[model samples]
Target: MKTRNPLPIVRLAVAIAAAIGSCLPLARCAAEPAVRPPNVLVFLVDDLGYMDIGANNPDCFYETPHIDAFADSAMRFTDGYAANPVCSPTRYSLMTGRYPSRVDATNFFSGKRAGKFRPAPLNDKMPLEEMTLAEMLKTKGYATCFAGKWHLGPDEEYYPQNQGFDVNYGGWTRGGPYTGKRYFSPFENPQLQPDSPPGDHLPDRLARDTAQFIDSHRDQPFLACLSFYSVHTPLMGRPDLVEKYEAKASRIVGEEFAREEQVLGDKPRRVRILQKHAVYAAMVEAMDEAVGKVLQQLDDSGVRDNTIVVFTSDNGGLSTSEGSPTSNLPLRGGKGWVYEGGIREPWIIRYPGITQAGAVESTPICSVDLLPTVAASVGYELQHDVDGVDIGPLLHGESLADRDLFWHYPHYSNQGGIPSGAIRHGDFKLIERYEDGRVHLYNLSDDIGEQNDLASEQPEKVDQLRDRLHAWYQRVDAKFLQAKPDGPEPWRP
Candidate 1:
């Protein structure tokens, strides 16, 4: 037994040798701190209209001083778009870098309302096989975290922590902060603190959780996806902010409601043309404060320069439904339509040292492009095929090929938007309505409001764009409207 104890002595000698080796000026231990890897932060707001922020529309009703200042320091996209007109489909695209239509995940999860026809066989959950942004970042030795709004799946298996995140705070099955007083204290969200005071707000709390994650993971690379549930529905705001906006809104004078051209449904819906919703305005400002707090944390952690920040929305604002809270005035159609207002989002990217301050890019970008862009930015090579191209070139003050952008949403939007597919090629865009196969064409450069229809005038362009859109449907295996029990068969692509 005493002779066999030599193994312990050998272990002690090895430990001493390793400790001395670490202190030695070896390349792995001593080369300028080895330059900690870059970090990624994706800030997503829910149902936020493009013009709702002061950066896009300064004369607008709501105030977003923090967002405006951030826009001044970041690169703004004039032609950014989501993958669909609704939230879930667009969210799926951002996670997988693939068109939501590929899996028939076109409608918002579990949404199957039959308008003129039954919605296509719905795929309600994001497939677990898909490599999410968090999973990919993890391969690069980065800690991943997701906070707020995980509406991708119907159960826990599809939640962020299961998908790839090491930390998940306030992300669960429900889309909105629908716990306790809804957005106030005692959230009752199992993933978040449940015993908060009545006055505590959801957005601010989510931001604090995210800031703490950054501080804890500051020693290593990390990806913090702070997706907010603010300004979505069941509108509520800080009482002080509500009062502030109420006073500010009183000074403005204009009609609040305007008749939107009847796009679908039996009756015409009134869209809020004025941005004077006091509660919504307050929510916007509070969300801005949350954004500002996270940005400040980046500086406090001494990781600001090493981070790539992105800001966008899941879909367009709630101008046509759920109270018609805000207006998408110049942009036709809100949350559910296949028009500019439903899909054109306010996208911004800030790459500290690499990007110019207050720079603007006119190139068209989609939600799917996010995965590949972040991959390239972090020097990670993607092994899976994706529908989105890397817009990293555009971010570097270079150019991207004039490629086409596409969207597919086959469900009746709770808002006034119809089931349709749209394609944007150069300045010409075409919308294909599913009920009767009728197409509406507009030159977006000439008609940002999408008022003038050129389908009859530009038949050849229509044919060209329509052909391209059909080809995409085939490529993505897109699904469309289904016939009802006694109803006419819906049009097929």
Candidate 2:
């Protein structure tokens, strides 16, 4: 008789307790909160091309098995692009999430004297006015580290530490660590010691540093930027891979042809290029292996599921105009031009909850998008003005409204030819040559080669893009001719 028909009262008591629990202060809550935040690992390759990865083009000169494996677990961005045509500028854009031109750094520098147009001092690095991604992430209670190339600035005022990186293992100067004697060397080089080296290879050395960073901070949220200087000029590779490439080069560039050209006192056009490509391929392979090592470290650390990994290059592959002219074939021109080959680079993002594995995001995204994208991903609030919009929606399979992408490469490059600006609106692209102020228009949807110049036929379209480009240039206060107007021509558009 004591417990008879008491079910209704028991239910009422349970409801009252639930209501009280919901009303209690969060601090007094019964369940302990999960304080974990995702880790971010960015593997930035130097001067990589559009078709470098197996996923982009399997028949590419450099076969990247490890990269393909990583791509298997990532989302491949087909239309990814660099913020600038060259290295230093794109790097600056990647770190700050702003266009390089806006900062008066439109070209690559190695702590050298600046040219007339770009009068900014190279001795000083990226302006302290700009906030770095690392600085912002550190505010969110994440441990930040930068391994490898840090070209934004060289002086103490511009060092990685000053930029908010807690620890920076191997990055100084404008270029990279020089291995052997060469035609040219960077101003400051931090040589790696052999016996206590991170790995036998330079790429592996950088990878090892990244692994250490991850291992030390796996329990907590971390931001590790691993920049590998592989496959750049002065192509160097492991002795074994070098030998393999040497054998391959010997067949491709036939000894008889090489000797015959020498006998005639003429250079064999194909011999040097063939040798370079072989070495270049090996360098790329080494870089891919470095990426593999980092991926493995993430997996072994039990934080792979919660880590968001991004892989990309600073700019397009170095063209024939530079030291080592890696090919960016079928896309026209490399490195310094306004062509697709110069700006387009490989991009892959792997995050379990945010991006789908094996997904392809062909939505156009520039290097400038990185800052806003990462900020959103890391749950950070950005106060500074950012030119790029958050591309997290695109990564999540959401549709973005059609928008035009513009570029302004003002300074004349040492190798890849003259100054230029370009605008990509939908499938149509308008290229403006600064040398002659000539406008070339092409529908990239139909012509990825950019072989045709349809400016005459598409006059109205050309004028529209040209005006829009310059209007933006004015809006950003882009670097331009100050001393003398470069002779006005008819506005064709």
Candidate 3:
């Protein structure tokens, strides 16, 4: 009649279940069902050169304490490169993980300049059919926000919002901050309404907007693309910073800071041998300050530990032209040239648990690599073919197998660069000019400045690299410059 004491039996069964659960894998009985996805913060600086930051350039004049400190705490890629030597194309590559040539967006949006040969067909807008990084992440329930420059398309239909960003701020067609009276607000952007106080700097306002977006979306995974419209054209900076740089410029020691000139074609391009443009230095400092503000916000929101931060530029500095602002010296030509200076960039990535702090990877990485690396980080499977390989292994202190890097810019650059296609298979790089098909080879390890041409002595190496470059062009279905029907004019700078 005791009925086997059912209550005692039930208590014993519960105790046994607890013990088994404790012995099982933590993931099986974790209090938190799933770990939250890390947030992504991309700091895309316009026209920032490879040697612009103190970590890359030992004697850089501009004060980039924030960026330098960031590099010191992140993984620095010494041979990082942009997908193109121009803005829109590199930006497109960043978003799509494909070469700009594949989408026919090889130049800045609405860029119609003609040269000796007619430029290849241009795609003014990024096609909606192609998946964007934001779009891919959005599928995984991430909030995507874009702040600052968006030159992907000419119309509103192809803007950040239409391209999977839930929030778009200051994104428009123009490449530079040419609207809203340039840089300072009353910005002419339709997506971004002017709400800040008058005379507020654009970079600072964009940073604040990004911080606000992060604050609002703190509980969820988010992608905040902070593309700064700084160190671009209409180089304007805060007055106090400008004054400080001017004072610094005045106290310079010798003719050690003299400007040099080189003839690229018929025109003499003034090369900035030194990094002491007062206004430009100020602009760089302001941009760095803006970056500092965003980083500080991440710290304040307590998400710094779980956020992946990437800092890079669309292309090299605007040294050869466009006010000749900053310098990319000891590397060769500036933005638009298919040289070390034009494509090489200051790339830094920070992933709290994955990447070792202060590590340096000399293995060259391109802007297209960003999407795949980020996708891998978030456990997203990429369905489309991407030109860039996931560099996640490199982040973890492993070396990637040597691969050929390619660049094809068939149109003449406004910055005094000729049309050319280049490829680097190893320590050597071969550049083939579209005008004459003449190839120039350089041993980048020995001649980082690209001063010596070793094509004659290294003919076989040139042939090998050229063949690989042409093969890549065919693989990517790259378009080439066509001879004008009226016959090509004499090549000019």
Candidate 4:
């Protein structure tokens, strides 16, 4: 008999050993699980009004097809509001999941414009000790990135990187894109490099950077915050787009586009009775286009199904002043007042498999609720105190327990708003002017414009709301404007 080859026996033995190693329960494998955590994208727009989007206002002069389409597939919060009626404080609430009053960030930072009452000692920078939404998400292994306006603090240490973001594109202290060359290339922003081609728009550049981040982190969970500085001040748009809107405006009937004046506080504020501003309309369309680009990138990457998208604004539109670009018609004050128009925002959220598509929730929600909602969506538990309640159930078509929403603005607004505090419980709202102790009460369900003041008629209701508001102020240790030792003159910047 021929001798069996020992080499063949050795090869078979090695193959068997390798198979066993591969099948071992404790051994690591080359292939990972197909499932991954959902990515989060927050599209934050600055100075966008409640009625600007077609989804919210069918009569809007500006076209926002992309936003309206997104709303069709998302849950729209009809009564959504910013934490404060300004940029920095509302942004603080978004990042911390707490009322801005709790941290003494009650107004736009560095707002030196004084009024009859001295603006409550302003906290110019967001406190570093407070845990931000990004920091909490990072603990759960989410790659955090921020691109856009970050007016939370005044220094570099208070920027996005220091606030828990792994990467920051153009976040800085300035609320608007007033740096570099305004909204074009060669930006003077210290955090962002001027790498785009000449004459490149800031919003488009921001969207591109954000899309690149999403592309690079497709395989992992990420939080991409795209905050647009468009439609704010220094209203500028592409020449072609401005012409397009101007032509559209010219076609409208004379009665359709008219200007009106309303006496707010002690001054006559000119309100844009209609949305006919050509430059403003162009800015809005450009912003919508940028949003479309980002959403398209998400779809092209094949990760749209596994992403959670949120669209909102820092505050109401600029109507009373600063070009008086847009109208918040039925909502009362804009930007810095305590009226419905000032704090109300467009809140749209899309979470695949969780939120019901094309649903509407009229329950009032605030920016403070964003953090807790995002944390719960990812199955993470928060360990610290939060003023916002988790509205996850609301997304699934379940009702949340009724609660109150509050706002405190002790400084005068550039848009001609007085120092005021407000509280909303159910359909009734109360506003307290700080200069004097005068209170105004309105039944929002009956008078959404806040034109009818029922405080004098309903004394008991006013007393009840005033007491509760004061009690809350004590609970949060809210700061207030102090009386000037000497009779103070009307404050001007």
Among all candidates shown, the one with the greatest lDDT: 1
Provide the overall lDDT of each model, using Cα atoms, as 2-decimal numbers: 0.89, 0.74, 0.87, 0.88
Specify the poorest-scoring 10-residue window by lDDT in model 3: 255-264
Candidate 2 minimal-lDDT segment of 10 residues: 256-265
Candidate 4 weakest ten by summed lDDT:
255-264
Candidate 3 differs from the real structure by a C-alpha RMSD in angstroms, to one decimal, of 2.8
The residue pairs that clash in candidate 2, if any, are 125-153, 463-493
Model 1 lDDT per residue over 174-222, tens place: 8787878888887888888555777789999999999999999998999
Q: After superposition, how far is residue 139 of candidate 2 from its true place, in Å?
A: 0.8
- Where model 1 places Cα greater than 4 Å from the true spot, the runs are 1-33, 263-265
Query: lDDT by residue for model 3 over 227-312, one digit each (tens)?
Result: 99888888887889889999998987543323333223454666666677889999998999999999999999989999999999
Can you give the TM-score per candidate against the true fold?
A: 0.93, 0.85, 0.94, 0.90
How do these models rank on lDDT, best leading? Answer: 1, 4, 3, 2
Compared with the true structure, model 4 gives a TM-score of: 0.90
Between candidates 3 and 4, the TM-score winner: 3
The parts of candidate 3 lying over 4 Å away from their true place are: 1-11, 18-27, 253-265, 488-493
Comparing 2 and 3 on TM-score, the stronger one: 3
Better of 1 and 2 by TM-score: 1
- Candidate 2 whole-model C-alpha lDDT, 0 to 1: 0.74
**Worst ten in a row by lDDT for model 1:** 25-34
For this target, which candidate reaches the highest TM-score against the unseen true structure? 3
